[model samples]
Target chain A: MKQRTRFSRTVVGGAALSLMLSLSGCGAGSDAADGDTIHVLVYGDAANKVEKELVATFNETSKVKAVLDTIPGADYQAKLQTIINSKQAPDVFFNWGGGSIKPFVDAGLLLPLDPFIAKDPGLKAKFLPSVFNSAVVDGTSYGIPMRGTQPVLLFNNGKVLKDAGVEPPETWGDLLAAVEALKADGVTPIALGGGDRWPTLMWFEYLYDRIAGPELFRKALDGDREAWASPDSRKALGKIKELVDAGAFGTNYDSVKFTDQGSPTLLATGKAAFELMGSWEYSTQQDAHPDFAKSDLGYSAFPSVEGGKGDRANLVGNTNNFYSVLKKTKHPQAVAEFLKLMYSDQFVKAQLGIGNLPTTTNTERFLDTAASPEFAKFQYDMVKAAPAFQLSWDQAYPQSAATPMYQALQQFFNGSMDEDAFIEAMRALPAS
Target chain B: MTRTATPSAADGTFDKADSPGIGAGRPGFLWAAPAAVFFALFAIVPLIMVAVLSFARWDGLSSPEFAGLDNWKLLFDDPVMIKSLWLSVLLTVLGVLVQTPLSILLGVWAAGHQRNRAVLSAIYFVPMLLSVAAVSVLWRAVLDPNFGVPAQATWLFGDGNLFGTQAGAIGVLVFVSTWQFTPLHTLIYQGAARAVPQVLYQAAQIDGAGTVRQFVHITLPQLRNSIITSMILMVVGGLTTFDTVLILTQGGPGSDTTISAYYMYQKAFKSFDYGSASAIALLLVLVSTLISLIVVRLSGYDKMRSTMEGL
Candidate 1:
């Protein structure tokens, strides 16, 4: 027994030693630093090929070669926060350009782009002023628009609409009527990605903008707690509840996600009538079901609310993806050259090919050559003529407020929160 | 010079002269040093760091600043955190109640069916082999209202919406967790059952004890250690249920299924409130430890320890 115990102990000790040695080897080393290579990190997606192609183009003649790195979409923010403070921080990084980059800017980890803009007036002048302003924190630009504007649009399946013998809703009343008609015809009125929580946010965004106007959100964004408690805000909340009760979004919206292609699939397969999504839905659908996208896909602005204060053409979404320079970058000149390429005609044409409506001044000239010229013209005209384009609430608020804000909106939509409780929660959001 | 020898050495009990020079009748503290160092580096250091961080204000990007009980104060008042904790505790309790007996029965049946044991075990363990992400996504697809089993059921019944309601979400989560985790507990119980001496069971049967009686008196006592251990592990897992909930509901359908760990993740990663997240981590640890201790005590773990020592 003693000898057997000793043998087992020796075996255990040997295993432990081997485990320790193997684990030591598992510690990941940092990426090799290239003296003449500047790293560019972006959110990985179908768009990654474009970034890689651009990087290759830049590396052809540039002194400092641009290396593209991508973190998967869901893990991007968390991974960026982890690496941003370390020696592995990228020279340039992609961001949503608003509250997404505000924390980094506050920490002084990001470099302001004012000097770069001053050096080259075309860099600042080439992009749309409103779109470019999203990246400007406290009147100081910190990011350059890298992708096209993504204004939220009411996407509908033409086949589903035609099957129901109903036209796409032109006003809020028409939407309610269409909801009834679609329900009568045995189809869901709207396919909402409520499981993602952020998709449910679109309803609140469009409704608030239409009912109370942009100033209501502007005041709320500016930290006026009363803005959320106003009668107009309550009215908007009531309208959303009304829609929910009317089965406009159906009962299963809470279980479907845009991220998972759940709600979009419903629309594409004609199980649902409409989906309020960003313009990227066009590309997404075009990829998933080319046949449906070609013949059945239709896009329009959100229906106007009766007696609403906001403009009919008002839009809401991300202005564009931006490339912000980290203060620790070793190649500022290379980064500047990269930013300049965002406005070049090639950039405009490449983005249009992917169904993205670039906010560049040169974008209009290339719209005729777009993958879907009609859709591109519609988004461009809506953005250009809009009196206000309220940024998504989650993007407009600080990062800390995002989870709670989404929770509040979701709770209100699901009837877990009353108007008062929702107002209270909004007021309780972290100021910083 | 006076020669002094330790009791162990002087007693000639160990035959020190015949023993090896290294670790000769002595506890090898040096051999344990490596394990101690590893534990200190990985577990102790992180635990201490979390304790310290709970009292500071941090936003991941910014430098941490001292916050003097503010995180704790906020934790007490935070409705979401409170709800999450309650849900976590509830889930843990339910998991224990639901999984223990079911696993034990399955484990015993598998052990008895010696010829088909391999096939039976394999069938039961398939869910355990699946990754949590895969399990969640699979269940999500299976329960989807459009084309899933629930939708198919609607043809027989009318509008089966299982994953859409709060109770239904919780029920599905619990059911899925059981389906995936019962295999693990069954394997554990099977090992413990196998470890039980054949002589004891033969004696029980010779005394005219039935299978049910044998299990109650012999198997139950034999499996005491495993039952307590598995219960604690499953309970801790329930408290920290994140992956399943994250992929399944994302704490959705109005935050009904949001467990504490998921809330902590959101607090740290999404909100960037590392300080508060650390506080939550510490709180969850305390809760888990306290519950484990209670389980150990109530399960007569101390009594078993004394009994084993006497043997």
Candidate 2:
């Protein structure tokens, strides 16, 4: 009996040791006590340069080493998702401020910023209410909006318009007339890339918001009301169809890749007359074509429908694209401090100098009037307008509903399906 | 005769005390312990987990609930899933039927010609050397209507765009896939064909058989195993093909080119419907397994193996 007991004890001890070793191996903690290193994940070339400058400044002042991993805007989400799923999420990473962050939040991945915000008086007052509200979910803020983008009509050169003998459109009718005039001049009226489903959906969402207004759009997206039967939705769909029918897009638009189509090569070469794109295109076009002048570029809000309820200046976008600290991170306090440094006056000045729109309300004061005249005018117009800001429809909707809707819109624009069919298909999407 | 020898006695003296511990009983369990533990950890455990999860609803992160047959039912009812499964089958059949014969012919052509065979084989195998992403991107550009070689050629000939219609897109996809995969099959078939005896061809020639007739009679029969093996591999690969279609069309023009694997990916990652995705995955596994079994039987591999052993 004594011998048997000793053997059993030995076996039990072996099992215990193995279990302990396995558990320890599974949850090995990183030794980051040096306090000299900081990691940041940022998006876009412009943002990357600005981040590097800020990090350099921080390193010099604080005697710490800062590293920034910059991912492209298109690939950032997928890469971030991989990191999060691997449970090796970065210390600081880019996060969109609305339902886009909900997946991470639901996964218990993001650090709530309420305590940090309460401690920092500068952050509390500096952020706009709309921008700050985008970060809140279930009464907890998960991200700090670093930059905001409002949807604006990006047009080609004034020379092209003058050659076509058309004015910048102020109303829906004028927009149609401009397209016709450009078409007559042997120019592709609109440089739309329907190949990427998302870009095509932008037109749909813009028209939908303009027709139905924010409240109804929100209600429809939330599944509280039906969107398919709405006359406003129908009219919006019809407008997209009309655009398609008007030879606004290039031949073989469906087969064209978005990168090839959206690139400034065609527009710069004068193959296409106009492109309804976002404000980011300004920097992109300038980079692509060295000869492109800021004076040659034109920016405006989407023209208002003649009898529509939505106003011309009803901005459809969000203060998305920001960074949030991971809840699973070891150094929460350090991460919050990094975020504070990122949004400081010096960082804001650097960002604005690089022509990026900062989310902080006070950041506008740092803008140099002499440096960027276009950005200065945009800032003034933004404040004076008091425009109704609507969230991006695809961004606001659940991914299940959103992806198919975007795809359907692409199909509709490709002339494979009609507006009514597209709306019906969207309505028929499975709710989960 | 055994009684006369008494084998144990002839060898040495037998001890009754050691008899119980000797090779009289079943083998020790320790021999199988490692294998059991490995299988339990790697295969059995995960399979059990997947099977359990398949019957329940979970979003990969959240708590699971008993879903019963809801997911499986959704699998049948979902039109996109059904269409994708049909497309996958079509791709498999097409890949096997078209690529196998072409590979065999190339393999036969290059087997005996030693002088230029090295250069020829290298040229044929170039496509297989490329990564899937690289191949997809290369083909996408080649098939691109606005900026591709094909489009430019079509324009020169006054035929318009090559990727404008559904048939054109599918044609390019099929052509690219076959071009990329035929090289791998050719190498496999060539190695097997080379192993066949030259004596057999001489015998066929003595019987007044020409090159084509000898190939049909002796060469094909000898290479039946290799052809079947390559066919099976190609079929399996075709059923799960995703990268080329994704890079080229992204299931655009209303999900025209969406296959089973891409459909599952879109559901699980894009749509965040893990339960439905899991259901589709389970169904795919069952279908693939059944098809593999049928193919093995139809290829007469078991009969061929028995015949070879008898010879």
Candidate 3:
């Protein structure tokens, strides 16, 4: 009995020790706010090097030195949400303008940049209007564009398209014809990373913009419920259903994820004819399969819908990353000075060097110096000519609405939910 | 106050006052305080917080506001929630049913093998040693409908989408869970089986009983405590399963394999709806508690305790 008691006590002690260790692994946010140092938190990725270099440059001759902190890209948003309300909140942080920052804007946690814009008119005017406008909530700008615009384009494998006897689709009808031709040639019409959910959303975003127009999304963003029930929305949903039924995305799309490079692998290997992805696919392909990227990579704007209200020149995707200020920060001026670097000529050159197409007005001249001049020029010209640029719906809506919205899209594509049900799901999404 | 046989009210209860043991009075409360505090901090406090959060509307970012029963009302009409709840219960039932018998057989087999017991035990326990994330990723690659081993094998009969269908996803989940966790139960039962005296099996063999008959009559009855312990563990693990499901299917083709815990995770992390997530958590806890209680009662754990004391 004594032995048993001792054994159980040891077991309980071990369990408690492990539990404490696991709990200790959780973030106890750092204190970078104690001195004259300003904390700048950015999403950690390949782009972190650029941010780090920039922070070092900022610290050289400033009264208030800036410190850079990074959270891994996958966990960045969740970590930010947890720490934002605490005293550990960064004075300046990275953000995607649209709905990503809306909650903070609503909570009045973010500082409005209008006064900064007033101080220097060139600050707002330097970046592309569409890119600059994404971070503006209630006519008050909350962030400055810090990175390049990411427009979703139809990325095709040239060799596969050639084998299938099809050109890169220029219109909706042409895309349908390509799909049929590609299917006949025994290729998956498109490689879609439906398992990731976000990749599948690009289809709906482009379709809605091309069919109904950007106003519908803007109305929906403004919480106009009827915007979802409109004929344009139904038409877009119908188009999605038609594509699914025709096997445009092939079977088992839901099992593949972009994060795992499953869809990209399919496209590169000629198992699939086309993929619709962001401009980043260029770098991704270049990094993974250089031969394919150098020879057979082809990209084109999304096809225009026949007799649709929206412009053929319209674009859809992430506008850019931004640096938004916290309302409670002690060093707003230092942050403003730091943000000024985002629009400088040095910033444009550095960003372009990394294959990021800066949205700064001066970026046009620096495109020739970009890592891939052709890809940079193509993306820049596309954005420049676009009459309207629709933000991705997931990013445009509040974070709370993301799961339901994705579910509705998934259900629709999978044929489990009809157009009305999809619309109802949209209507049911928590208001931004 | 009656003082015939019992102590007077001023002298407290008869047993407590009569007893001179170290834990009889002040020392008893003091001795128990640390464990009580630990329980209150880890278990009781979290439960209370979950209960309070269930009735409030808070996105993890903002402060919580009183939401009344709106979250519950939403849950009533939520198809995904209902499906997930059913799926969790189904998973738990399947886990206990399939895992118990299979692990027991493997355990008994290992126990009887004197020459190869170490090797056999090592082989059986390999899956349990692997991390759940690693196992899930390995299975995902192995079951990929396009390039997976199963997909290639299925091509012999005809092509089929393995992870595309609801039933197929559930089957895969159960199979993977069993594959990964059966080893743990095997180890548990092996220990219990070793405790049963060798003389009993010898006596059974002398009585002209077959291996099957000996196992049914001798091995199983001795493994009662281990089996009950493993069942509760397996049931709880199944009900709260998230990592494998998240990595393997992500509760998809269209939320078909979603369990309640996965839904709760989606609400809290994906949607940031802490209130709704808290509600789901509370519901999950209640379901788990009731299920555990039923298991304990049906398995006669109280009777087992009394029997142990009588021994």
TM-score of chain A of each: 0.93, 0.82, 0.95
Q: Write the per-residue lDDT of candidate 3 for residues A180-278, one digit (tens) a residue.
A: 999999999999888888899999998999899999989988989889999998999889888999989887787777877778888898999899999
Question: Which residue pairs collide, candidate 2?
Answer: none
Locate the minimum summed-lDDT window of 10 residues in model 2 chain B. Answer: B1-10
Candidate 1 clash pair list: none
> Compared with the true structure, what per-residue lDDT tens digits does model 2 show for residues B51-165?
6766787655456788999888878887778988888898788778889889999998778767888897888899999987788778766666545675468645233233545
Runs in model 3 deviating more than 4 A are A1-33, B1-35, B156-160, B305-311
TM-score of each: 0.91, 0.81, 0.92
User: iRMSD per model?
Assistant: 3.4, 9.0, 3.7
Least lDDT summed over 10 consecutive residues: which range in candidate 3 chain B? B1-10
Ranking by TM-score: 3, 1, 2
Deviation from native of the Cα of residue A86 in model 3, angstroms: 1.4
lDDT of prediction 3: 0.85
User: How many backbone clashes does every candidate have?
Assistant: 0, 0, 0
TM-score of chain A, predicted model 3, versus the true chain A, to 2 decimals: 0.95
DockQ-based ranking: 1, 3, 2
Model 1 stretches astray by more than 4 angstroms: A1-35, B1-27, B155-160, B197-209, B305-311
Candidate 2 vs candidate 3: the DockQ winner is: 3
